[model samples]
Target: MTVLLVDAANVVGSRPDGWWRDRAGATTRLLVRLAQLPERRLSGPDGGVVVCDGVVAVVEGKARDVPAPDGVRVERAGGSGDDALAACAARLAQEGTPLLVVTADRGLRARLPAGAAVAGPGWLLAALDETGCVPPA
Candidate 1:
């Protein structure tokens, strides 16, 4: 089973799609999109099928209060979202779980444990689109 760790703030901030107006709403939208994804498979970076068994979205700042959908777990960060993500990644790595981290932050990417697959928010949005999880424009 592969666990997907999302940096909610980074992903929500990527498109500049009026997310600045309401961060929590944007985060909620993202989580709803993620929850809509098919449970069995997603397109991998290498063009193969990646099984996503779990999803964890780390939310910070004003977005921390946003509720998560059924298939997605929302982690409200007490401080830095990046720090919470890194810590979760580290714990998952220690448990020998395959991890896919979705974020565009360079520093946060560097902080992730080795062997974890990293993808930018663009990739995530593309996947969501491919899966017909389109959000409102």
Candidate 2:
């Protein structure tokens, strides 16, 4: 299955829509977008997990255990989310799961495996459109 590891902070900071001004607003928007993720067509399993610095406890679009109606999962990171993600990616890669790391941080990118796919926020937004990750409002 494709396990999408999302970097919440990086994504929020990547947009120039003034999301940084309001962390909650940015997080809500991102979660909504994540909830709209689409089914994978890559000839294998696919899923997405959003790593946030803090936990929201409950999210409007959350779908419990199962993948979101679309194909994403939202999660909160403990103290070191990025480190955890990199480590998870490495382990998942070893197990043969397609790991797509979404982040704009150059430093974090260096830690991913050499062959892992990395995309910035702009790229992710475009992908959302391409994958129809979000349904029509």
Candidate 3:
């Protein structure tokens, strides 16, 4: 079973579609989209199937209140989003669980636990589109 750790702020802010203007609203929309990930068959960077048993979206600042959905958990980062995500990855990795970190931030990617796969925002967006679980408008 694979567990996904998402940098919610990074993914939500990847596009310039006014996310900065309303961070909470944007994060809420992103959380709704993430709720559909579990049932969808997503493709990994290696062209293999990416199946997630659990999805954790780490948010900070104004976007910390997005509620969790089935198979998903909304985590509020006490400090930095990167640190929170990295910590989650480390904890999961220590348990020998397969992990995937979703974000396009290079620095964040570098900070993830070893053996964790990294996927960018575009990858997630494409998968969501393929599964017909498009992001809320």
Instruction: Please give the clash total of every predicted structure, in order.
Output: 0, 4, 0
Instruction: Write down the lDDT that model 1 would get.
Output: 0.87
The worst-scoring run of ten residues by lDDT in candidate 3 lies at: 37-46
lDDT of 1 at 50: 78
User: Considering every candidate listed, which one attains the maximal TM-score?
Assistant: 1
Error of 3 at 100 (Å): 1.0
Candidate 3's C-alpha lDDT?
Answer: 0.82
Q: All candidates' TM-scores?
A: 0.94, 0.66, 0.92
The clash number for model 2 is 4
lDDT of 2 by residue, 1-137 (tens): 34567776677667688765766666666666766553444211123443322111122212222222233455544456577667766776798866667778788899998899776767667666666656235
Q: Tens digit of lDDT per residue, candidate 3, span 18-82?
A: 98899998888878888887755677767999876778899998887767667678779988888
